[model samples]
Target: MPSSSVPSSPSWHTRVELPSDVPAVHELTVAAFGRPTEAELLGRLRTDAGWIDALSVVVTLATDTGSPVGHVVLTRAFIDDVPALAMGPVSVHPDHQRSGAGSAAVRASLDAARAMGERYVFLLGHPSYYPRFGFGRASAHGVTLTVDAPDEAWMALSLTPAEHPLPSGTARWAAAFAMP
Candidate 1:
């Protein structure tokens, strides 16, 4: 169920940066997730064929500390062979959770996607969290996942309602995501 309370914004610096920031971004992901797997996945996605240049975003504290407090990434995915985006593994430093770092990253990334003319986006994420960004059950729009997931956990968002609209089909990640 969606929370009755809106999430409070984090008090930190948030902006998008260049590929030169990839290392710091990876480190932030590892620290936030407490695992190397997501870091590895992000690395692979950087070189994947489906990667999109403008969709990656980084969020950091406002103090100019030169360290990222959170990160969010989106890459090209497909629904029924139609172009879309996939948001994943957004991470915020454990100490910074509820500070709005993660939400800032997500909001930035989605804004970037919309600016780039993307229509749809899919994500496997916290049921309670993503809806604040306009995400709804993928099945509600005829989208699904190859791997099993609860209906509430797999979600989709439409950035351009008039053009691509919402499509129904399996969400296919880039080849990088298929690697071990």
Candidate 2:
């Protein structure tokens, strides 16, 4: 595992999550959060209409040839009536935390989203941690959330800003989010 401040090594292999990877990803999510809430959310999202199989990413140690130690998901969300994506339930095995595995998974997911023509992504995450991935205040782009969270924790990223700027309006996460 790489430290948060450290860059992920080139040895970290990133790829889309496969059906065979589901169990490992679930266990990793549970281990990372020390709870099943996030994992449960993932389970629900998997069968939901918002699920995008290509946007689920995992990271493994190229050297070890083991199961993925990191995972991330970008599911269907919306800004106002416009379609968008929501990044969440990012997980890295506890044993692999602080290693660059988490970052690699995140980067891979975002890249996959962009490649698939997604333009906007919104999330509630650590302000300091997510900014490194080009996320900024969602409020700055007129994005709002009904969920109870600090102003700074709500962030947005424009995957293709030059072509399509970040949209504005209340973010509508997947039903599984159950945000009020």
Per-candidate TM equals 0.88, 0.92
**How accurate locally is residue 68 in candidate 1, as Cα lDDT from 0 to 100?**
83
RMSD (CA, angstroms), candidate 1:
5.6
Candidate 1 local lDDT, 1-180, one digit each (tens): 886987755467667757678888887889888999999999898899988777777887776646787888899999869888889879887878888888889989998888887888999999999999999899988897888788999899998776666988878888888921
Off by over 4 Å in 1: 1-10, 162-164
Candidate 2 lowest-lDDT run of ten: 2-11
**Candidate 1 Cα lDDT to native:** 0.84
For each candidate in the order shown, give its overall lDDT on alpha carbons.
0.84, 0.90
**Predicted structure 2: lDDT:** 0.90
For residue 103, give model 2's deviation from the true position in Å.
0.9
Error of 2 at 136 (Å): 0.3
Question: Which numbered prediction scores highest in TM-score against the true structure?
Answer: 2
Question: In lDDT terms, which candidate is top?
Answer: 2
